[model samples]
Structure formats: C-alpha cells, structure tokens
Target: MDDLLSGLRMPERVAPGALFLPGYAASIEREALRGIAAICALAPPHHLLTPGGRRLSVAMTGCGAFGWHSDRAGYRYVSRDPVSGRPWPAMPRSWRDLAREAAERAGYPGFEPQSCLVNRYDTGARMGLHRDCDEDDLTSPVVSVSFGVTAAFLFGGAERHDPVRKLAVESGDVLVWGGPSRLAYHGVAPLPRRTHSLTGPLRWNLTFRRVTHRQGP
Candidate 1:
C-alpha cells in the first residue's frame, strides 16, 4: 500500500490550520482496521447520550490511554471503558505513529495523542457540528482518519452559525486541524447506504487527540 500512497498529491489546505490528506492511511489501513476490531472486542461500541439526553447516532469506542466519553454528565475523557469497567485497549503503535506523522505534516509537530475516539457510523447516522473542547491541550491538532464507506465531512468556523464547507472523505483519508482551527466546529453528514470492500456498510473513524496538558510528547 505504500506504493498506493506514493502517487498521491500534497495535502490540501482546507483552512488556516487545517489540512486534508488524501489517502494518507492507505499504507496502514489493514493494520488500523484490525487494531480497531481488537479495541472493540475489549470495549464494545455503543451510542452515547448527549448532555441534553439525546443519543448520538454514531456508535463510539476507543483505544489509547484515554477514551472520549459522553453521558448525562457531559462529554469527557475517561481512562476506563464505562461499560466493561476496564481500561480502554492500548493504542496501537501504528495508529500513534500515523497520527503523529499526519499532525507533523500538517504543521503541528510533537503531537502525542492520549485519546483515540473510534466512531462507527452506520447508514443514516450523522454527527452534528461541534468543537472538540473537552481536551485541555488545544494546541495539538485533531487527527481524524477515515476508513470504509465514503461520507461528507462538514467543517465550519468556531461558532455554530458559521458557514460550513462540505468535503467528501473517502476511505484512507485523513484530516488534521489545530492552531487557529483548533476550536472549529466540525461534524459528519448522514452516511448514505453504501458498501465498501473492506468495511461493508459501515464507516469507521479514528480521531486522535491530546487529552491533557501534562501528557508527555
């Protein structure tokens, strides 16, 4: 797959501090998917309740030291799986290396992500525009890797009412945003009923974040 990524073009700047990397994860897709499956085996994916009591359409799970969670209390990161009551599966080295390399390529170097929120979007599932503010280390970019079916990614400014740009994200694509765009509102549009050779009818996303200011580089 390294040969597959070699012919790709340079990263496209989507905003002041946001870059869209086409097929950035092509080389590691199989390993990443296997890692995600292993993580899910230990910590099953489930829809989380929003602070408003609404249930998210996307099923969520994670790996790494911290996993992003949402409940009646609100969105936050926890060291253990809320369901299994065990530590989230350790983040795979390939995942960490890919995230770090992607962030560095996007101009945010030394991004040591402590949380990797894995979201599974079945057909018709969609995420509302929102900022990732739970993490204290806002300087580190959010490195999002997409696999499986294609979906529309909505990237917006800081405010909820700001204009949004829709981008088609296919399997193996990566999007990194931070710096001025760290607080940008972003979400996934409703996934169309479709199939990918690798993931069948689902779209998988691995979102890497630096959850705290104290974590090492």
Candidate 2:
C-alpha cells in the first residue's frame, strides 16, 4: 500500500498533521458520484437551521453508524436521520475504502470512520469557521474529499482569532487532518457562481469522521 501511494506521489503537508492529496479521488470519481446519488436518494439533503435559528447555506445529509446533525437544540451525532426519521443509509463500501486509504496515506493509519457527512454547497453558500469537536475520539483523523467546482478552504489554529491559511481545493482532492490539528478551526469560503460539467453550479464535500461517542436520539 505504501509503495502504491508513494508512486502516486507524496502529499503536501498543509499543517502539522494536515495532508493534502490532490486528485487522489480522481480514479474513483465516477463510483463515488454514484454512491453519493444513492445515499442522497435515501436521505435527501436539506439546509439545517442552527441553534441560533440561522439557516446554514450548505445542504447536508450523512450515512454510516451515525449522522452529524445540528438544530435549534444543539449540534451532535444521531443514529437516525432527523428528516426521514430512519437510520441514515449505510456508508458505501467504495466511499469507506477511499476514506480509509486517504487517511492512511496521510499518516493516520487504521482509521475507521463511522460517519460520513455529505454537504452540498450552491453558489454563494459558505461555511463559517468552526471546530469539529463533537466526536469522542480525537485520535482519529477527519478525511475530506471534494467534488465539482473548486473552493477556498480555510485552515486555522485552535483559536478563532488565529491567522488562517487559505488553500484552494479542487475536485477529486483529498484532505486529512488529525492529532494536533483535529480540533483546528476550519471552514469553506463562499463559493463563486460557476458551473461544472459534473455538478453544475454546486460543489459536493464528503467528510469522514469516526464518531466513537454516540449520543441518544
């Protein structure tokens, strides 16, 4: 596995533990897109309102052992989909394999993500800087895959006031961050209005996480 990954080329270390593998997901783009369609069909994505009652621009859904959710109540992981009132669809094998491989290539081996958050961003949609801390196991890394239009990704330090490093993430790119950078504040800048043959004027982001800490529904 190491040899194969090495042949693919070394990944750029964006931070202490954050590695960026450009075009790492290109080979399986078609399969991953199909899996996204299947998962979305089962649990349609929808914009969620925050605890502050502000609606998020990104529409989202999830699949795996748990689904990340936020609402007027709070943010946490739930075993069932808040929309369908059913268990989130099982994680696609292809998706899981890609995530595990990407994580391992980024230096975090033995990563078993139990949750995959699928987020869809339309033109003008943006995610605010925030830390992903709901998961119990901080030891495991978060693997993110981008599809469709390119966007600027902001990676910052532990404090919100810390300077942020902006990086452009293109389709088929994989990013993994864990260990010291697991709780770093990060977010996506507002997407520019544009169209891509594969996704039109939208971008799809898949975030894989191991939600070892399960909360009651």
Candidate 3:
C-alpha cells in the first residue's frame, strides 16, 4: 500500500466522522514537540508487556488526567504514573488546544480530551490491529497527531476481518475519528529506517482521547 495516499495532500474524510488533516500541526510543531519532551521528562516512556508476555516494540508515556496502560493484569487507564508513583504530567495548553481544534474541524465539536498517550516508534516498530475501546465514553472522538518520520496508517472497519485502507501519514498530520466509527480498528505498519530533520530516526505519535464523560476543572 505504499504511495496509496500521496504525501502532504489536502484533507480527506476517509470514513464517516473520520477526517485526515495533513500537516495540521505544522503551525504548532515546535510547541507540540516541547510539550512532549516535558511530559516524557516527568514520566519517561517505557516498553509495556502485553497480557501474553510479549513486550510492545513501541515505548509509551502519557499526559493529562489519565494514562493508558497494558500489562499482564489487563489494558486500562491509571491516574498515577507507574514509574514515578505520581500523577501523570498535566496536559499542555497547546496540546489541548490543538486537539480540540482538530476534533472540531473533523465535526466533533467541544471535545475535551482527558488523556493524551505519547507513543515513540523506532525502526521496525508496528502496532497490531485493535480498537480504542478502553475509554469510559465511546461518544467522544479521538484526535491523533503525527510527527517525525512518515508512516502508513492502517484504517479498518468494525470487524477484525474487514478490509483496510492504507494512508500515508507524515509529520504534522492530524487524524480525528468518532461517532459511528468510534470503535473502528486501526494500526500502524512497521516503520522504515529513516531519519527526519526534527526527530532523527524516530516517530512520535500523540493520541488525545476523552476517557470519561466527566468535565475537567
């Protein structure tokens, strides 16, 4: 599926309530990167082991009120950082603003994400097909921002066997999905060994989600 979707193109609505905004984060790239660095400083990224004892290739950390975690116990959200035994770093205003604006542009207005998961993918790292179903509220949309090297995003339907479409996601791309397609399965293909001017040989992904329906202070 290489070159299936050309790089740096106009916004595309690939599915119902799912919109891809290419280079959407270009304006705030520096601030976003800084925010990520701060969050990682507070809660450094770490590889998580799956229930079956397989270690995830991607290193992960998070900011905001909740942090996504997976272990032999199960996949769920925790308010405290497992590493530091403290609350996850607060979500940066820039990060929240970008996420809210992106969600609104994708037709999901008034989105207030309570959690932002930061994932770092190095060469050969790939995520398997799975749905974002751990959130307490499924009605809210998910806003994802991509930075560093380009990646092929796999977007699938509701069923596991459903056909998938590959889309090339470059640095500064923002993807928003919710409503009817809230639980759609998706994953990232293995990243090729390449270097970006800003992030070197790695790719960073920020996924903003409204984990609960409760309002934040």
Per model, how many backbone clashes are there? 0, 0, 0
Tens digits of per-residue lDDT for model 1, 155-177? 99988999999888889999999
Error of 1 at 212 (Å): 0.5
Q: Cα RMSDs of all predictions?
A: 3.5, 4.7, 2.4
TM-score on alpha carbons, each prediction: 0.94, 0.92, 0.95
Score residue 86 of candidate 3 by CA lDDT. 98
lDDT of 3 by residue, 1-217 (tens): 3345454478999888899999999888878888888888889999998988899999999999999998999899999998899999999988899999999999988899999999999999999999999998898999989999999999988999999989888899999999988999999999999999889999999999998886643
**lDDT to native, each model:** 0.92, 0.90, 0.91
Candidate 3 Cα outliers beyond 4 Å, as residue runs: 1-8, 215-217
- By TM-score, is 1 or 3 better? 3
Quote the lDDT for 121 in model 1: 99
Tell me the deviation in Å of residue 147 in model 1: 0.3
Give the per-residue lDDT of model 2 (tens digit) for 135-215.
888889999999988899899988999899987787898999998899999999999898878889989999999988433
* Model 3: lowest-lDDT 10 consecutive positions: 1-10
